[model samples]
Target: MHDMAQAGLTKYVAEFVAAATPQDLPDDVIALGKKSILDGIGLALSGSVAQSGDLVRRHLDELGLMPGAATVIGAGRKVAPRFAAFANGVGIHADDYDDTQLAVASDRVYGLLTHPTAPALPAALAVGELVGASGREVMLAYHLGVEVECKIAEAIAPRHYQTGFHATATCGTFAAASAAASLLRFDAKTTARALSIAGSQSAGLRENFGTMTKPFHAGRASESGVAAAQFAAHGWTATDKILEAPRGFFQAAGGGYDENAIRGRLGAPWTFADPGISIKPHPSGSLTHPGMTEMARLIRENDIKSADVKRVRVGTNSNMPNALIHHNPHDELQAKFSMEFCMAILLLDGKAGLGEFTDATTQRADVKAMIDKVDFVIDEKAEKAGYHKMTTIIDVTLNDGRVIHGEADFGKGSPANPMSYEEVADKFRDNAAHARLGRSAADEVVALVRDLERQPSLERLMSLVAKAG
Candidate 1:
């Protein structure tokens, strides 16, 4: 095996570095960039009250160290850029409602890791504001960073995901670093060094989902990425090819690396195509959602009562075991990732929304009993597909021996079946409604996001987004 470290990230990094300015991208990418920016802002604003958001904010406040570099999303306080990124990123992901990417899946990760809570956009926005970079410049850096991160993640394939690493944290560092480097305009060598440094810090355990630590992963990644870029801009030195080198990111994190997946498709085939990223219609694990929706529909359509459910069997891909498999959840956050809890809520409540996953609901005796009756079976075929084309086969066996089977492909908001703009907006409003910001603030956000590109200054965009909604 050759030394992957010395292999060449220079050319790739240089190409990305050269195209860091917003003026260098196509019109479509620019449009997508604006969309992502708006989405990230919306998600962060909504997260202000989420358990994760409040937890992070209190932690930062407790630190009592203010650097006044940038604004923390809903707090109206300025702090160091690194901490700002950390806090805001946490806010973005607080509700488990941020975008996701189906790392090993062939389908576009699409909405899984889009503008909402996107590390690249918010990271760029904060860094750009601190350094007086223009909106166009910040957008450019964010787009380029997102493209690079997606490509690297796409290349890692079955390895990156199958090894149990969250693609967002592992690949997001590069995205964050690229955005920071672009805003700072670091040279090729320094940018490459930054990528290496950030690569070393990429980490997020899949097991941490449903706890406060999940958002912590996002915060840490954003901070680490920014730190890497700053270090590189200052002429710091490090390994050049941290991605492909032996025992490098790909080899170590992803099971096996595919050089072609990373190299040949940089700008030719834009990943931003069909960039209508999925906005969350509901705040729950994306995988668990399809089943949740279907179960709710069945209960509503057939009027199946909780008392009618004698047994519930959920068949899904192997990944479900890691996502939502709780028999009894103590709180809503856990219910968010708990397939059993979500399904039970679906059966009992006829829907799994914010309220269904609340602490009161998850701990309800009826819900707990229903969750216990829920069990799962893994389909090898879906597992082989790497859970990308995951489908849920739900079997509800009633007390009357009435067997109801429901199967759905590409649940709501999937690329195959995307949510309408109104739907996305509705979701945004739902999350942001009870915040300090009122309906008018939410409406202004909707308008600003829709007309993002036409604005003369990012100040307007930031002002509207930063409104303590």
Candidate 2:
């Protein structure tokens, strides 16, 4: 056999996405997929109404587009499927509260995996709606997208993230394309072209993490995916071997990649099922969840008042300090990427939920004091444990000479400690309520996704989430 690494990798991946069917998905995969789709929908609703939400809910003219057949979640209007994908993707990632992929590679930083749902689901929803496809079609398309994206993420050079590329936007474009291509019913050759085209469009930067531009990356990736598929359907030209070309996607973008990560790995275990996905319980960078959980635990168990605490020390692997860039954040967006702010908010509020991450909360004197009290550091032990694990150590000092210690190796909502479907539904309810969605409609959306395979079309589901409920 020819070397799989240096030849036909693009066609190989494209064939998998183009041919995978619902029969390949087991009961549990569908169950977890529905949960993730539900989470993405809920987050998109809340994201549609944030203070910076106007960035998405704008006139089509401002977006340089006209109306089409696809729904923009919560926007009460239809737009081109690509544009719908763009807007809804922005909403899903706006709060950084969507589902995150988990990589098995030791060099990959914990919790920094691409926010898979943010890009994949929007593409599936947009194109699935565009084609009047069944719910199973959409579900299968989304799973295929996530699987391709996660496998690609696993194969790429670790320095891709270390050198500041946001994997969500970079790898996610491929996810979006795969999802869209699946829904569009493109053949393997056409899908290969789409994947190649998506590689050219892939782009995002870590420097944009704390601003609206961050979510915009996910939006653009989703949009680019939709556009790439459409372009290929129209016979757009591109190298079909983009992923394996001598100077192609992996080489140009990430320097190199591990071919073994892709060979026989696409659906061998279903990345969504094997390594699994994470539904963020908090609306911040997932890297902070472990510490946030520990902080919440400390306060809950000890009934420790913030005023009683003299200082807080949070330690993690060295990579975290670099990625959680906002050392002393002053806004909600910045606070999401700030370890200090997340810990402070959890300490002050006893839980870092939606209402607690407001800019007003960040600027509060007490919150500011708590921020100063947090000593965010790089732990030698955590560093030694390897970057693949998100290990965090916490030490709380009370003014009364009491010290509390907590360590978290895995986040509460991770595969190791998964939230049940019921729990995910609860989060969906809170997000829908945050977006002003009616309880009755929100309940129906949950039921619809829960029974995804039985549904004939996305008409009801899109109608519920796409309109201003």
Candidate 3:
């Protein structure tokens, strides 16, 4: 049974690798790819100046690899595909504020901070340009990469996640490899071998949370994936069945998986179509965003001053601790994982933006006082739906005895309640604005991404990212 499963994974990996390309990809897929690219670049540029981002750039510089194929969005330097992928991946995750895949159940089931921006974008861009793949081809590879990453997360999630593995980092290597392989038009055999290499190389530790190393996991995974595919292209081999064999990815890392989850919904039932994916409104943890938005809305609708609120109690699920790791985060990155900090800031300021996580914000005595008053209540029911349905029920007990209860069922940017195109564009522009790209540059990136399939080449897209900050 294990042998057959390995053979099956190898076969499918090969097929996906061989047939995957942007040339014939659907328009929606292309649009999604471009959107992801724009978002990644925006995030990367902003993160480039972040303390962690700068550190990664320094490390990459020390590696002394040949400068080549692709650009690392913020750094404005070109390097080998692997190093580029690594550095770019770190940029995307630096803020701890990228995309996520919510689990169906359990805090033990780690909800993946799944698709960060730079990893897939750089890998696809490098491979596509190197192979002379059109702009459309790059988009296809990206969409395919995201799809692969999300599916793998779903397959091993809750179980693998419970075991304390970062699904994005652990599984992302294969996802990136698959995307790069698709762009390179590798044979199925090579694709399978790439996946095999990725599986073995996959790693991420939960202990790394709230540290710079967490982002390193993302960058390294992407670099490894790109390297894996490139190595396979040269006839390097890996174990045939990386996902399904008794000793494969699923069986080894995945504590006890639903075997059906691995291959059940290959194409017909897609992760992209259901629960869809969240486009971040703020760069903080996705689990906390909804509550923050709702609290901010409540405070605004009632014109509640920050001083009026005596105490704020936020009710969520058991898994929230993962999202809100710090009751008092030492820095912006730590604050991003703190639920109390998120809620307090939302009510105090009524807006959660990029600057919300800064040291100045964290040091604000008012914000600290509010954060101190905030307490978390875990509801088991909310835990079952995974992090997706994090019901943030906030009861503000005022000094004047006005008890207001505000509950948010769906997080902002969730498919149940999504951020609009204008909002996403606005977010992209805001981040890009810091880089001084101007309104025209931001608009051009959005417009080009919106109609990516029609573009002759991704040169314009790449050019925008290569902008010096």
lDDT of each: 0.71, 0.88, 0.73
Give model 3's TM-score versus the native structure: 0.90
List where candidate 2 sits over 4 angstroms from the true fold. 1-6, 63-66
Give the alpha carbon lDDT tens digit for every residue of 281-351 in model 3: 78787778778778877887888887888888887877677557789876787777888888888777777
Give the per-residue lDDT digits (tens) of candidate 1, residues 80-162. Answer: 78888888888787777776543434543323432333567667877877887765677777776777777787777464555
Candidate 2 deviation (Cα RMSD): 2.2
Point out the higher-scoring one by TM-score: 2 or 3: 2
lDDT of 1 at 179: 84
Which scores greater on lDDT, model 2 or model 3? 2
Q: Candidate 1 — which residues are off by over 4 angstroms?
A: 2-6, 20-36, 62-69, 104-117, 157-165, 251-256, 274-278, 296-313, 317-319, 347-351, 369-386, 395-405, 465-469
lDDT of 3 at 257: 53
The true-versus-predicted C-alpha distance at residue 253 of model 2, in Å, is: 1.0
